[model samples]
Target: MSYRAVLRTPHALRTFLAALVGRLSYGVVFVSLTVAITVATGSYAVAGGAIALFGLGGVLVAPLRAGLVDRYGPRRVLPPLAVTYAGLLAGLAATTWRPGTPGWVLIVLAAVAGAAAPPLGPVMRAMWSQLLPDEAGRQRAFALDTVVEELLFVTGPLVAGLCIAAGAPAAGVALAAALVLTGTLAMVSSPVARAWPRVEAGAVVAVRVNRARLEPVLVASGLGLGLGALGLLIVAFATERDQTAAVAWIEAALAAGSAVGGIAYGARTWAASQRTQLALLVVALAGVLAVAGLAPGVAALAAAAALAGLFVAPTLTIAYLLADRSVPAAARTRAGTWVNTAFNAGSSGGSAAVGLLISRAPLPVCFAAAAIPLLLSAVLPALHERVDQQVEADPGAEHDDDRLEHLAGEAAG
Candidate 1:
């Protein structure tokens, strides 16, 4: 769990870097494609529709794709999809560049592009279980995963800005596709990936391990409410201020705060169960997000945003950790996908809901809307207590009740 261990372990380092590069590319691709399409058509609505289809493709099939990885291993599943996705992306860029290519045609290409893209998060997360058996080690790794994702979003937009400024926004998409392909190939080629265990029925799939892991997945979905709301608020607040450009940096500051928080959280150990920490962090998030709505101006919102983001990474890390431990190895990838699916669905739905509300109410209403999930998150103390009961029973779990108590009375009793 130490920094040196994560940094020094060859397999850990390799998995971490591969996931990082692939995610960075994914972060850049969507925005860059939107920019290219918007510039070409002079219609943000058209671009939005296309991007929505792209995201929908992934959301719809993520579990199925992840299941394939679980059943067949990453080596069998990732390479061909990566190659096909790369080709599709390149084709989409080229098609968009053609003079007067039909919008419908571009939309179809986008769907294919999304469908072909590798399920990077699920695969990498599944690998962590095989590579790191220590609970503390996995916790640190998941925290690092959150940090990498935050940094990727922060950097992705910057890269898109550069590509757009260069008068070839498609370059950003192509660049991202290239990075993902290269990184995925490298990851699969690694020794750990090649040796990844395939699930054989009745081998190690325990009944307890197969129990539903839906709680953390649901909380993760709830956690995305703020992020989705923030997406709309970016446009709403920026337009209201007549400095629409400032939204990017404001959001970047928030992501930066998240990344820093994740690093800090991982560097130290806490004497609390994952479930307890998640509940506390989520309640804290609710408070921070609500306070953000009352900020006097954009500058104030920036500070509030950063403060609000402080709990995000740690909360998400705990959710992933819970998912990893809750499922058998054969089902880990699929379980991880449930978390991803819920998170994306929440972000999209939350943004749309808040966007509609903004039209009928004050801007603060939008900010308040984002905090709704946090309220739901705050209600998870019961679930925390239940999960703690399970953990305390697990022989491998760190059961130091003297230092870390579940929120309720003895869960077993």
Candidate 2:
């Protein structure tokens, strides 16, 4: 095999390790911060409001920030961001005992912290494409990346719960922040991260509102909302059965299933077309809906939930890969921001919807409700592919479908 081939072969392992380090530290800190803020405020609503502020900052700035990554490269931007984030987290820790610290101050700190949120996930995805430099290698790299993200969250909350129980939530957050800074800095300095392509001057950049890049992003965002809803359902389902403590197990099973699916999909030599991936997504959605009908016990529900989650990481990884191939390098970060923003937005909506649904309807219905968007997402791939073909075949056919075609092409290169 050529040098590039060998390099790509090892990339999956390297990316997973690096991402694992980043995820463990950051995820733990995030959970700890949430717990700390909630305890200090003595109000779940206030805590949630604080979190909402952070999400808002992330959503508002993600596109602009992503553009910076595209301009400066991940290596250059990530280190400073990580360091600053750690410093801010430490500052929050220092002020944990100050009586009557205004809520708005906390909100501002949270927003700033969130705005500077680590670029590991997006930057790493971009690096995978660059490091692997082939369609197949890139695909596998994304698959593992998705799995790590899902898995890390499973550990993050458990660790945070322990720290909170021990009356040291701030310590946990500080530790998480320090580890994140250390891990990101270490990874960026490593040969793997440094091997990524440098940003060239005068690359064909496109940041203005382009319909071609917006539609699929919206769809991906919708998918995020659906996943968020699924999470809420899991929590509610467990709560309904008075197995609230088992929430961790539910999340773990879901993450495990997702990791397994991603590994299996990535290792396979026989690649599916984008269309096939979409079809499988539909199957996965069907499975999710089927979970609602499963027997109601922690074990059975967990098993069904895991099977349902098996499709999630792979599905998301494919979407990221498609967006990478479809968007221009100049617009890649913005495109990524669109997806991330969609996820955050969807998460907020899904959580709310699921909470309301659980109160008003059956638990199974909650699961089935989330499936609707998956079915829509499934249709998007074929429809997008057809639109892409049309745009390629006749570039000048000025039709709305042509606009949709342009968007599809932008999303699925």
The digit string of per-residue lDDT tens for model 1 on 1-413 reads 68678656668787778877877888899889998777767778778888998999988988778877887789999999899888888877776664466777778888888877798888888787777878877778778877888788777888988988888998887888798898889889888788777777545343342223766777888888778888788778878989788887788778878888898888888997777787888888888887677777788888888887788898888888888888877878888888888888998988888978988988877777788887785555445566557676875766534323443345435
Q: Where is model 1 more than 4 Å wrong at Cα?
A: 201-212, 386-413
Residue pairs that clash (backbone atoms under 3 angstroms), model 2: 212-407, 225-346, 326-413
Residue-level lDDT tens digits of model 2 in 1-413: 23235345655456546656776876786677777777676667766777787777777878777887777766887888888878877876655533355666767787898888776777777766666767777777777677768777777778888888888887887887877787787667656566655567776466555444554565676677677887788777778789999877877777788888887777665556755675577556556654654556878777876887777777777777767776765456556667767766877887887777777877777777777766666656666566666767987876756566566577678
Q: All candidates' lDDT scores?
A: 0.79, 0.70
What's the true lDDT of residue 199 in model 1? 76
> Which pairs in model 1 have colliding backbones?
none
